[model samples]
Target: MNNKLSLKNINVKYGESLALKSINLDIYKGEFVVLLGSSGAGKSTLLRTINQLNPLTSGELDFFDLGKIRNKKDLQNLRKKTGMIFQQHQLIERNTVFQNVLTGRLGFHSLLRSILPLPKFDQELALDCIDRVNLLDKALVKVKELSGGQQQRVGIARALAQNPSLILADEPIASLDPKTSHQVLSMLKDICKKDNISALTSLHQVDFAKEYGDRIIGLSHGKIVFNGKSDQLSDEILKNIYSSSTITEETNFTSNEVVMV
Candidate 1:
């Protein structure tokens, strides 16, 4: 597989507190990489930093095709090719499903162009994305009218509309029930595989990670505890990754902390 991203000695800090420390990792094209950790494990920070949402305190990120993300133009270009799926879905409640998904293409347009009606190709892509997530029937319905699962599926459709080479999902199923979480995750995994897009998803459920991840990365107190294939995640490793030390002192030590290698 091609190397989609490379993080070399990555570090991120919020004020004086360190969030991610000395992180070194690489994600390959078409791989579904699952991140497992507690609430303050910096999973969200890591995902955000990839798109330059969170500025790195010190590190070198080599994104595929774009090389190093060094300037404003490179950052903009990186974001244009990267899609983000949030835990809350982040859709405009008053907007229709189609409108919500169509916004994903905004990254590809100029400010003036975004204010205008999207091109026909973008409209068609939005419809295709909606269909892929089985929400074509709900496309015209207001976002507020959809169920939580349906709304999350719309988030998936919006990300799909980006035609992104990579998708970053931060706790995508956090607010979902068990059954709905499975449905959403299964759909996401299938889509990534079918479309050959790389994905980095943070999930709290260890079982779900093992089930859906091509590879699993476990974080603890701003450090990587484990990086291995799903089946290689032994019981002992899980214990180490979710050790009590991470929750008590480390959790309160700083609001953000975690890393990968």
Candidate 2:
């Protein structure tokens, strides 16, 4: 299978903190990989690096046709090839869902074209993306007026608008309730499958990870403790992935602080 992404000797640092330590990984096309770790195991940092949002102290990333990062222009285009879903649904709350989804196409247009109203076909495309997330009816609604779950769905639509081959979701369902979390993740996986988009989603909910992911990577203090099929992530393996020195499986699920756990 074609690799969706590949990293070799990857390392990231923020001042004195070592966020990633010589991490290496390869994700195959159309596969869903779940990233799990305690509060500081570097899940978010790794995702940020994939999009060139976080500076890598040392590493080489190969994102298929996007190529290696050598300059600002290269990184900018690389971002266009990938979509990111953040914990906070980072939307223009005041804008209607259609406008927000249209933002995904900005990378494909010039600054002037981006700021101006999108063409009719673009509007129809945005509506189609919204419909994929089951929010077609809410397309005209102002984003701020929507529920938290709906807002997150809009984020997914915006990412879809990018027409990205790979989607990196950082705690996409963290803020949602258990039932809603399942709904959101199921929708995410289903869309990726139908669209043939590969996804690397960070999640704390172990059961959800198993149910939704084709593979799992468990991290601890910027290092991978396990990288295998989700079924291989036994309770004992989970315990190792979230050791007390990092994050234990017993860590509070409600707290983002359990990032490494």
Clashes of each: 1, 10
lDDT of each: 0.88, 0.85
**Per-residue lDDT of 156-238 in model 2, one digit per residue for the tens?**
99999888889999999988887778788989899898988889999987878888889999998899889999778776787
State the TM-score for model 2: 0.92
Q: RMSD for all candidates, in order, please.
A: 5.1, 2.9
Name the regions of candidate 2 deviating beyond 4 angstroms. Answer: 244-261
Candidate 1 residue pairs in backbone clash: 222-258
- What's the C-alpha lDDT at position 8 in model 2? 86
How many clashing pairs does model 2 include?
10
TM-score for each predicted model, relative to the true structure? 0.92, 0.92
Q: What does candidate 1's lDDT look like per residue over 1-261, in tens digits?
A: 336789999999999888998899999888999998776778999999999889999989999878898999999988988999999999999999999999999999999999999999999999999999999999999999999999999999999998888999999998999899999999999999999889999987777888889999988777788999988887567657776343333232111223221
